[model samples]
Target: MCMPMTGARRSTSFLLALTTAAGASLLTGCGVLPGITGGSREPLTVMTWAPDGTQATNMPGMPATAVAFSRWVNDNGGIDGHRLKVLTCNEQNTNIGAGNCARRAVKEGAVAVVGSYSQFGSAFMPPLEAAGIPFIGGYGISGEEFTSTDSYPVNGGQAALLAGNGRQLARDCERVALVRPDTIDGDDLPPLINSGLTEGSRHEVADIRAADDAGDYSSVAAQALERAGAGPGVPARIGRSAARQQARKGCVTAVLGERTETFLDSFRRVETADQKVRISSVVGSVGQALIDSTGGKEGPFEGAYVTGWYPESGDPRWDAMRRVVDKYAFGDNRIDTDDAGVQTTWIAYTVLKQAVESLDKDSVSTRELAGRLDHGQPVTTGGLTPALRWDFASMLASADFPRVVNRSVTYQVVRQGRLVAQRKGFVNVGPTLENARTSG
Candidate 1:
């Protein structure tokens, strides 16, 4: 005597998947360069990623921020009387591009490098380390890069974020599924995934490669649903599958997606092809392009749950950040495009700035910077809660293996195909890291 499953039921299951999976991410914007009123001959340079060359053209905000940051340092009598010279590179999808950018930063005598962008963060690391330059920003928290003394990661470690996500899921859902890239930027999640689950929570995983060449989520969805006891199309099953699929794929579902719209197109086909299988995800799953391209039309992604990181700045934080962005960066109209990126970048810059200013001249060396970071300082940019600290060494202090704490966890849902904040509070689970290994 089970009731019929509907899209609503499916949606819930999908959200459970996203929230239950590992990791947290906060987007931040570019930092402003200081305006030096009068300065010494020495110039301090900062480098960042301008992949689309939009900083030069479309998004003038990024460069403006860089300029303002430089100008601020100069106006503040310059960093120890050294004028700042900011350099930005459009490191499009090529390592060579990133390498070139890094080389430029090094050649220009950059005391510290910031904002190299994603995987490029590591790409720039070796050079900065070799040059004995202190690097502070550029997101993505890979464990390998975290080991470097020359680099200070403002962003939380990926291992901790994922482990936190897993722990949260273990508490929230009986059956949880993981859908993520096969080649993650940092640490592999197999161990983190294992650590997050409780004794009896069911687990399923989908290894989506970088190219996303495969146009299917059915096998993954089917596997997860089967394990979740949703294979029979009962009311619970329908909801479970829908929710699980949505969580893992976002709006893409089990369908393939060459582009965001392609996901919607394929999603419709999948659902139409089979009405019983529900597919859902967090709101941000469906790309903004799809949302706009479809002119806000309802599609498979209409009611997915989007769980992502956000600062605790409240509404006022966003406003203050916006002013910082608008005043400093140019053509930042798309600030709304990726709020998390903006916030993260800002946080990273502010942390580095504070750290740099706070350093006693003797502690300017790379080793000193790394040492000082151990005290676990709290950072609050734009009033975001969840104070971040550095403890990778301690987290890895175990005799046999590394142990980590899932410091904080948060959740957001996709309403009207947009990612919106849900209840955001960290669960203080003693989540620990297990089985660490270098990826081949």
Candidate 2:
């Protein structure tokens, strides 16, 4: 997904020192604002961090999705009659790289910037905030991060939601062993998950740890097993003998790290068919790969209860997503819309596009963009995910966008290396935004 900047785009070195203050002043002094015609060609520039980074999947789905949306925009006469040009740069999760990228976008005069697949949006928040350029695709945990007053989270706040998955499992278990990855992927998740538990409902949390630096599943599995317990045929024991029995009784469960592939690798290294332990994970951990390899027929995870953020299997939204796939995804019909990353990316981009269209073209400044976003706006993306209503105050309070887009968590049962939705369709886990705090 790493796209090289076209020859028309500026180089990063010269871009870094470019100041938006001078650019704004230059626009004002030249009378560019008042004399600008509604019909003038102004390319809407987007700076995304998908291509180069620790989390880069090169899924071909994200960039493909962007291409489809851009094609649609162009076919419909473009944004406010100006041709929309996407200037993508791979920030590679470096502050210097991201800062340089933002400067280059501003230097090239991008009205809005879009990014995701990592924390680049948060890292670049200050610059974009100062430049007054709309920064979309940021999902930060800190209220201050979301309070940028210029940026808007296209995919909603993630820090709280990521943590909420662990909190939600507390009721079902008395003890949990948290085993996360030793990379940037699992950075913000552990702190939020541990702190969100209520006093009375708190469970015995095992040591929070990262997977081995070697990315070796055996060591990770060994460490997790040692924490749980060591017994005959019981690999990476994550529960005491009593806790193990209690796990069957719904008193303890294992909460693995964030990534789907990593979790599966560890599970495979330590799991046996006879091992009867209830495991829990977040939506981002849901993927066809896991469902096929571990959660499939004769796979290790036959009865895992996976918590998903969006409804995927048999979801009505997939009908619309199919339209998007047909129109944009490319030659392969096998694109996994069910993949959590793919779904989240799809919704994130759609929300950003809708936010862009909702703003008053005359005031395309980032502050106005953020303001328009904070208030309720109509988002019609024809996406596979439910419509998003970005309640900015709620978003501001919880380090998450406080809005409910249907309270359903798609749970699937693994059968024959495939996930088959249980007899229950999409299960409504109740409104996710009830705890959202907002100060009027």
Candidate 3:
């Protein structure tokens, strides 16, 4: 018979049992159990989060695209025969909500968080970093997206687009009016646009601030048009001839996020036929979806100049993505092929898949996945971006955004209700951003 344990022995045994149970519980909470889940042949879990049904901004398509991508990949034998499991969360466009989503990703043991949209990067990135999870292809709304170590953004984000737009418009417009939100984020826009204009030997833009959630923008539009020197009473059929009349034409570029459509609605109502102001915006603020929702050919965006991070939706490079949507996401109205958010999600998953394939392993953890990416391997997005490598050499010299690897933007024009390439190649804005950083 075993002798009865004494006081110290019994306490030590009880403490050991308590610690063991706690360790198991912790692993379970993190969604990592060797044989039970995340096994060699089990599914690889990831997450995508975006704001939905919000008062200010919404990006339901990001998560919707992630779900569709999981289905498409699973049908195709998944990433090296391992099914991809995607968890989605609605950030609700708030700081607390963004934090909650990041926490959920950690608790659910997401290997990576891919192709999500949120302005509250400050709230979300810390949790993701603490959990050692990589953040891939975040819609570049917040400054934190560029600064965070874990973030791997696919596009040059708004920085490249605004600077590129300034370069494009500088070639034509005599005066440029910049209409942006009256927030902290808006403070950075003027300098960026100015950097490009300064590079092009053009005058700086007339800065106009507007409320982000304002229902009426007629006054703001009127102010922008006036500042742009878009005097009323020009003929409606100005045509390309307006391009030649450089002295009379001024460009109005709006960087407001979702409220851009509302602002345009008010702008059209106040804008006269004579005003030859060329309306301009980045892709996220104005795209094919908005053009279709507003009248197509007769929409406010017609003849507008737009800047984007990728090739047009009809580009042959997107053939594979289109095929996936056609086969897997049929009748899924939420997944718009042209929406930049949806496109970003596709490209992000492509990066994730490549990383997983490179691993060539049966089981993967968040640490291992992030390690592979941080090792400086370049990811090719089939011409969507230059082979993306986040090594020190790939990073820009900008003091504010050292991790901006892709500095290319495409210039597009709205014609016949479609966004077509105005210039048939990518324009590198790395130099402009560098200039801005040094000057700032």
Top TM-score model: 3
Off by over 4 Å in 1: 1-42, 53-83, 120-122, 141-143, 157-161, 168-177, 182-187, 206-265, 273-303, 312-315, 360-382, 388-406, 416-418, 427-440
The candidate scoring highest on lDDT is 3
Give the root-mean-square deviation of each candidate in angstroms. 18.3, 11.4, 8.7
**Preferred candidate (lDDT higher): 1 or 2:** 2
Taking all chains together, the TM-score of candidate 3 against the true structure is 0.87
On residues 7-53, what C-alpha lDDT tens digit does candidate 1 reach at each position? 98756644553465331111001122233221123454666554554
Give the per-residue lDDT of model 2 (tens digit) for 1-440: 22334453535422532456664454345433332343344556565544433442333344455556565666566655545566666665566766777788778777666544444444566676677787654433224335465655443344434345545555554455556544453454455445433322455445445542334455555555444443333334543233333443221123332344665576666755344355555554555566575536555555544555555455676666657767765655435666554565566566666665666364355566666666756565464434545564333333343333334444444444555564344443333333433331
Clashes of each: 56, 10, 2
Sorted on lDDT, best first, the list reads: 3, 2, 1
TM-score rank order:
3, 2, 1
Instruction: Output the lDDT of residue 228, model 1.
Output: 36
Flag clash pairs in model 3. Answer: 233-274, 234-274
- Higher-TM-score candidate of 2 and 3: 3
Clashing pairs in 2: 174-251, 225-236, 225-237, 228-237, 228-238, 228-239, 229-237, 296-417, 297-416, 297-417
TM-score of each: 0.65, 0.69, 0.87
